[model samples]
Target chain A: MKSETVSTLLVEAASLLAIGMVFVFLFLALLIAAINLIAAFCRKFPGNFPAESSSVPLTKPLATPSRKIDDTTLAVIGAAVHQYRKQHQSNVKD
Target chain B: MDKFDVLWQSTALAHFTLGQMAMMLVGLLLLYLAIVKKFEPLLLLPIGFGALLTNIPLAGFSQAGGILFYIYEVGIDTGVFPLLIFMGVGAMTDFGALIANPRMLLLGAAAQFGIFATLFGAIALNWVPGFSFSLQDASAIAIIGGADGPTAIFLASKLAPELLGAIAVAAYSYMALVPIIQPPIMKALTTPEERKIEMEQLREVSQREKIIFPIAVLLLTILFLPAATPLVGMFCLGNLMRECGVVERLNKTAQNELINIVTIFLGLAVGSKLSADKFLTVETLGILALGAIAFGIGTATGVLMAKLMSRVSSRKINPLIGAAGVSAVPMAARVVNKVGLEANPHNFLLMHAMGPNVAGVLGSAVAAGVLLALVG
Candidate 1:
């Protein structure tokens, strides 16, 4: 009796394995076709949806230069560069 | 003197049993693995803590009217937490790789053979004395082979609520050990040359295709296998929220805050089932053993299937990515990539592996549905 019950249970489990694996394969196989169809549709009609570029920019444009540098500021900037280069040259020589 | 005696009797120390003490130690071991070893800390930590709470003598944490009891009833018994977790997983998933190469779905389906094969293993155990598993119990145990924690918990809660704790622990612990468990099977099945083969790059998938992919998956699932709709439906909703790009806030919440909250409750609820009466049994040992065998079989089948595909296809396909079909998410995929890299340093298989990795998620969910439909 015990052996009979075990055999029946094993048979049921085997059937389930067959059915489950086949159904999983079939469902996913159909999904593969659906995905391919969707891809083909999107390719045939690219303009149906708005492009991502049309959205508002996510970041603020780095603060634009509104005013030109004055002669005094440029001279100061030039002097700073000269000083830094002189110090670097001295350090390298050392 | 009577007051003193009554007070002493009420203390936990007075009521402690050997079983409770052993279960508490098991809880501490889980905590050690989660904290010290860093094995799936997100779920294991809370699960461990809940185990501690539930096993306290006379605490009644898993009994009627306790917080743990109510949480388990509301979350696990109702089967809400796992579905919610699946939704969050869907929200976080990117099907770009899957879409670029749809053939990988076969690899995903092939991996579920582990789940079904383990069903036979579970039932065969009944021949042993002290081991008698009904069809439902066997089904619940077999899903641990899917290597999906949420799906395992979902099926176990529905089919065999008594085995939920063991199933969940086995599923998650084995998932955490994917790196260790999968490599040997993968290496043994494939040639070193096959591991080194690199495939063509995946094409960029347009956002439009991404938007439709989830809907398509849901449609196919509902039309053919309605039993799987609950898991697949919530998963699609989460994926759609992610891909539609209009629901950024909802998508973010679903993947992040919502998932984290549900995970905590889900872990604790699963832990509540770890009470000594439920956990310290001969069946628990059987479950743990069968769980490992399931994982080994799943990984082996996945690699063998990949080898077969490689032999037939004109394109050179590496067999390592097949192991990713077991669906430990990016972890399985990463292991594949690592193995491939070890064989050939320049050969990167991460993106390729992701194709089948995500498919394995669907595969397991489908397998779960099948088990639910057949056994439940």
Candidate 2:
């Protein structure tokens, strides 16, 4: 009875292995297909999706100025430049 | 004199057996390995300590009425602990890389060849004298090849609880040894040129894709292999908690406190099974040997699969990432990264290897489900 059981188990194991390999392959193939389909749909309907704000733009395009900088904006820019020079000079000294 | 005799009788010295003494030493060795070598210290340390506690005479810690027994019966026997651990693993896992390039799932699936192949190897061991393994036993033993600790423990608990101690030890030990074991096979199979091939950067996977991924996978698994639902279902629950923004508290608890608490109990329960009669046998040796062969085979097949895929695919794929298909998670991926860097100084394969690494986890769970459906 024991030997018969072992023989049966051995046969079962071989079959299970073959079945397992095929099952894994088929399941993963389906997953791959699903992912591709989703990706294609996303690409085709890009406007419906949110833009990626987290990524920094590699190069900013220069757009024509809509309006001239006012005196207040110039004053703020001057103050910012002064602060940057002050920090840069201090770091240079250090 | 009666009082003295009573006190003496209560001492472990009065009841110590050679088996208990030997098991105690084994426990100490595990402790040393965990603490000094830092080989899976979090789990191993508790396991080692539990071993020490169980082996002490007069404690009866592993007996039916004992605390360890209750923990084992409630958790390990019913297969709750490993499922809880899976939930935590899922919560911690990030599937962004896997979603970006779904082809990595092939490597994951291929790595499971180790598990199924080891089934035959376990049964083949019956040809040796004084060795006999039933089909259920072989199924439990073969899962060590999956290189997944919780899945191995869960499957072993269900199929062959008697072998749980040896199989768990083998599974975790092999996982820890991924750094040592994977590199040589990775190097032997690939040329320097193949090893140095730089993969293109993975595209950014959207938050929406990430959110839908666990649900989609869970639904697919339930439809095709409902047997896998226990492990995969809990895993998807954890992943959903992580991906969905609303359950931050639940996610943190699953990943941190809940898993930690269950890990302690799980380790103790596994260690309780390390008594000499169970652990010190010819079968233990067979299991260890089969586990090594299984892990080795899995690693080789994963690399081979990648090599085959690289030829068919349009883009270049560094075959080292295929070694991560063994499901040792970040460790296997890290090994691939380290190996890739050695071959080319500028190469970074960490993000790319993660694709196959996470896929290996899901693949192993599916394989476990298959085994359970067949043999359980």
Q: What DockQ does each candidate score versus the true complex, computed on alpha carbons?
A: 0.47, 0.22
TM-scores for every candidate against the unseen true structure? 0.92, 0.89
Worst 10 residues of 2 chain B by lDDT: B241-250
What level of docking quality does candidate 2 show?
A: incorrect
- Tens digit of lDDT per residue, candidate 2, span B1-376? 9999999999999999988888889889989989999999988888888889888898999999998999999999999999999999999999999999999999999999999999998988887777789889999999998898999999999999999999998888888888899999999999999998998989988766776788888888989999999999999999988877666778889999999999999999988988888888999999999999999999999999999999999989888888899898889999999999999989999999999999999999999999899889
Q: B41-82 in candidate 1: lDDT tens per residue?
A: 999999999999999988899889899999999999999999
Report how far off residue A52 is in candidate 1 (Å): 3.6
Q: Pick the candidate with the highest DockQ.
A: 1
Q: Which portions of model 2 show Cα errors greater than 4 Å? A: A1-5, A44-94, B1-4
After superposition of all CA atoms, the RMSD between model 2 and the true structure is 6.1
List iRMS for all predictions: 2.5, 4.6
Which one wins on lDDT? 1
Q: Indicate the worst ten consecutive residues by lDDT in candidate 1 chain A.
A: A50-59
Looking at candidate 2, what is the lDDT of residue A89?
Answer: 100
- Supply the global lDDT for candidate 1: 0.92
